[model samples]
Target: MRTRAAFGRVGYMAGALALSLGLLGGCSAPSVSTQTGGPAVAPAQDRDALEAQIAEVTQALRALGPGVDPDEAARAARIAVLKPLDWAREWQVVDAPLVHNVKVVNGFREKGVCQDWADAMEIALHAEGFRTLDIHRAIANARNIKLEHATVIVTADGQPWDSGLILDPWRIGQGRLYTARVGEDDRYSWESREAVRAWTREWKARALAQQG
Candidate 1:
């Protein structure tokens, strides 16, 4: 009895429901891989490239302020660049990030979502307990449920979150890392995670009052 138009509407609604469920399960917007293949042990050339990046990041961290310790900068740079790559292999990330996230949510895999990477990175950096640096958690597109993303940011001690550098591993997928200033990243507008949580709580409270 249903017309073709009704069938199209049903299909659209089903697709939207899948997307909403995926996002609610801690996945973010789909991401394109910067590299073509899955995670692998860095070959000689890749190791050289990674070392070069570590040095570059170290230099940037040291430039944050005179109070930033050189030793801490080097250590943080190494961990920030290396841990995600290790996790990629551990998570068996053989597909694009969103694909991997679906597998994870469906019980085919364990963890490799954007939030997983962010949480692991934050925990590893926080464990270092650096005296001259601060590790922060941030969310982008927090007001948009479907497009939300989370990341780790690093700043000089006492500097605000926006002044930090974003270390995002999920954006590029396949274990490749992406780094940019919180203000300079072209893809997302960053907000402190704590602020977003507080705002969400207030919004939920208002909704509950309206229903009463």
Candidate 2:
């Protein structure tokens, strides 16, 4: 497991969605802003730059093999999505979801959350024309409330049962993101919640420390 510090490298919260959206102007981290859910337009220059990066990553993915390599494509797609999101997060341009503690489903009127990460991933990947994976939102350890964790799931070639990957960038810090087979990685299990309580306790403690 990654150190708690790795998860809270950047601790400040974002402001209103409009203001936070403005942080996208230069792709720098700034305090995030929250508002009724809406898509914020990124600056043209930043968007263009991201587009170029996606194109580059796509080219590299192509070199993997003739047919679409779902794993490779998924990896590349995660990177493509994370790069910009990291920029936004680093600059505080991205809003994080509100968490009162590890147990409550606090209101989202404050900032971004798990849903934000998933939303950003889906939006950016689609914008990049990444078609290798279908995005799905899932809960880890559905049976346990305290350990229930939300994550973004990707199905290879839009097929959930065929091949799947988990694009969980929020698992670590220092602009880190995690990608793994849906049920293969020991990080979390899709079928049955495993170690979710421990993981949540660890992460929540780390988060609280950061806030302190």
Candidate 3:
């Protein structure tokens, strides 16, 4: 089966950079203007917290033993996503799109958010060569959608929806990643195929608005 990484390679980076630069739809979210010539103070606490978490994950990987070959990189990336997910909540403004074109900024956020999580995970998992999992951008509803979420859906035998193991790091607060079955979990409302297709239409419309 064709992997999502195959398709996302070119578009992903460009889209992410555009979103980060506040160039999406020519709309800029309110940000702290840096007009001072003084050097910006570093965020020491946040940096320390992130480093500690990475070290913790690295130590866990080491516990797998020297002889045992583990997918250390993938495990590390999964854990690292938590830091950005948590940071996005505080760093990002939860603003509804001024126009459909500008929603990409809200979805992508300044630092990282739900779509960013999914996009990053999708890129990471693909790079890790996970043959059984596919990344899906799952939305909650079809009409008047708000804050659409995303996750990596794990399949048991490389078949879509065969088993629903959702890896969603943005569903809850704190530094924990939320992973669960699609329908069984209350953190997200899983959309059906029809609903997903409809949501895609809306998503594309938003994207087009940015392009125009």
Candidate 4:
């Protein structure tokens, strides 16, 4: 009964300037770039792989057609993303132990591919049985992009969400769901970019990569 938000997807190369000390002032991220400066066009084979997977789940929705389940779509989107994301790795490439450091975790063609893919996955989720909404937490606001998370709300309008049971894939293994609050007293279930950067600095102090 807990309607929640989830985030997924990927894109090609994107570069943004790093600001110091977690301040908001930083060079803007370079426009989306792929090996050829174009979107990383999915190959026929990869598209086919997702096509059927998406189709299978889409076909499963009792109330939907052969291709519409938001939750399933979200699941499919995650599957597509898994081909590129390293859910197994903790730090998806940090830059010299600094927050706002440049670390390219997953982007095949590199156009904020993660965002694009995540969007698509949300569509998939809609095709399934769950109603989904998108949320974007700026990296500048959080520090690390992954740590600077974007999540999906698996509930539709008029559905009440449990402010205490939010789930974030990035911070996996934390059993209880993160509660979301709308006011000043909310403990950040979704951390801010500044917080992520600060955390990065702490990470470097404890366990930073020996080389760049």
Candidate 5:
């Protein structure tokens, strides 16, 4: 009986080993190790491609901006000055407003806060390489309301300066240029806002220097 029991135990041990092997085989595949030290990450090629695309788009946008219109591009040299500057963020010293106050709301400039808008325009013109002319004539439609109205006539060609006041910003549109040049009696008029026109050397020496 003891010998029979030993044989039975051996058979049982063999069966147990076979079952263990079968169970391990049923597991089928090995799991990829994702523990403390896993596989190396693939380089982020897609991320770099996206960044490169963004840079190209930005360059395209900047290239589109400096386009010239001959008439319009002429003001590129000075538009930076009259542009609505962020006084609060950049130039706290001057305190220019983000929005300009011209005609509608009785702007600080219109109400005589930093020189009548005309004088301010003249100063800007002078600074922007422009000169001015004061019209004391009895022209039918032109007027100054209070003072002898002065306007910046465009004389780039040195023609006989026929009060064709070429205020520059108006050049942005031919309509604006047309209207600013022809005022009340079909004569030309523009409030001396930031000048679009400039003065020649001859006029600069005479009009502005002799004023004050």
Candidate 6:
């Protein structure tokens, strides 16, 4: 009794619903980081591994500068590594990032895309209000809509953006955090988020003028 278009809409909704239910049933919550003052939610083996990573990240942040506060470094490292994992679990990210992007686009998931990861990380770190550390937002492949990527960078306060450390969780997927110095990252040439936004605005204006 339904038209073909009506039947297609119904089928799409049903598919999305099924995917959401499957994700909920399959993904388990990740353990909270010890530095966050919460009991571990993971098994003993996984908990040990996560703790080791937190320590490593802490060391990396401290090495950024002699003036970097030890306490601030430890806190930043803990949030950088653990927050994304928590988000991944909540978003039920069971596939690679791009694959999960499809899920989000189709309404099978709420949020797990690269931009979402970057935005979440930046917000969490900024909340710490570190006096010895600075947070930056960056974009890669800004001219290519299909390949554009966003990430959060952390640097010693008063240091240049290029000298900072990159905190990216969406690259490897499943909430596995990746960190590297800005100069060491060979995959993408990063640009300041503000610069990219200004360029985008100018580009749109040019396009509109040409069409007029």
Top candidate when judged by lDDT against the true structure: 1
* TM-score of each predicted structure versus truth: 0.83, 0.44, 0.44, 0.27, 0.26, 0.78
Q: Top model by TM-score, which number?
A: 1
Give a tens-digit lDDT track for model 6, residues 90-201: 8887665555665687877899878899999999999999999999999887876335788999999998887899999877677788898988986777999999999999
Query: Which has the better TM-score: candidate 3, or candidate 4?
Result: 3
Cα deviation in Å at residue 166, candidate 5?
Answer: 4.5
Candidate 4 per-residue lDDT, tens place, 121-143, comes to 34544554434432222222254
Stretches of candidate 5 exceeding 4 Å from the true structure = 1-73, 76-115, 130-150, 166-179, 182-212
> Which structure is stronger by lDDT: 4 or 6?
6
- TM-score of predicted structure 6: 0.78
lDDT of each: 0.81, 0.46, 0.47, 0.33, 0.29, 0.78
User: Once model 1 is optimally superposed onto the true structure by TM-score, how far is the C-alpha of residue 144 displaced, in angstroms?
Assistant: 1.7
- Candidate 3 lDDT over 61-167, as tens digits, reads 33333432245533543444454444445544233222222334445425344556566656655665543334444555434424455566544333445245565
lDDT (tens digit, per residue) of candidate 5 on 99-159: 1111112222233211233333445445554222221111211232322233333332323
**Tens digit of per-residue lDDT, candidate 2, span 15-68:** 333333442222122222233222233456666765665555555444334555
Model 6 deviation from native, Cα RMSD in Å: 8.3
Q: Count the backbone clashes (under 3 Å) in each candidate.
A: 0, 21, 0, 44, 6, 0
In terms of lDDT, the poorest run of 10 residues in model 3 is 33-42
The TM-score of predicted model 2 comes to 0.44
RMSD (CA, angstroms), candidate 3: 14.2
Q: Predicted candidate 4: what Cα RMSD to the true structure?
A: 17.4
Clash pairs, candidate 6, are: none
Q: Point out the worst 10-residue segment of candidate 2 by lDDT.
A: 97-106
Total clashing pairs in model 5: 6
- Angstrom error of the Cα, residue 66, model 2: value is 7.1
Q: Listing every candidate in turn, what is its Cα RMSD in Å to the true structure after a full C-alpha superposition?
A: 6.7, 14.2, 14.2, 17.4, 33.6, 8.3
Give the candidate order by descending lDDT. Answer: 1, 6, 3, 2, 4, 5
- How far is 52's C-alpha from truth in model 4 (Å)? 25
Task: Give the clashing residue pairs of candidate 5, or none.
Answer: 130-198, 130-199, 131-199, 168-196, 181-188, 183-187
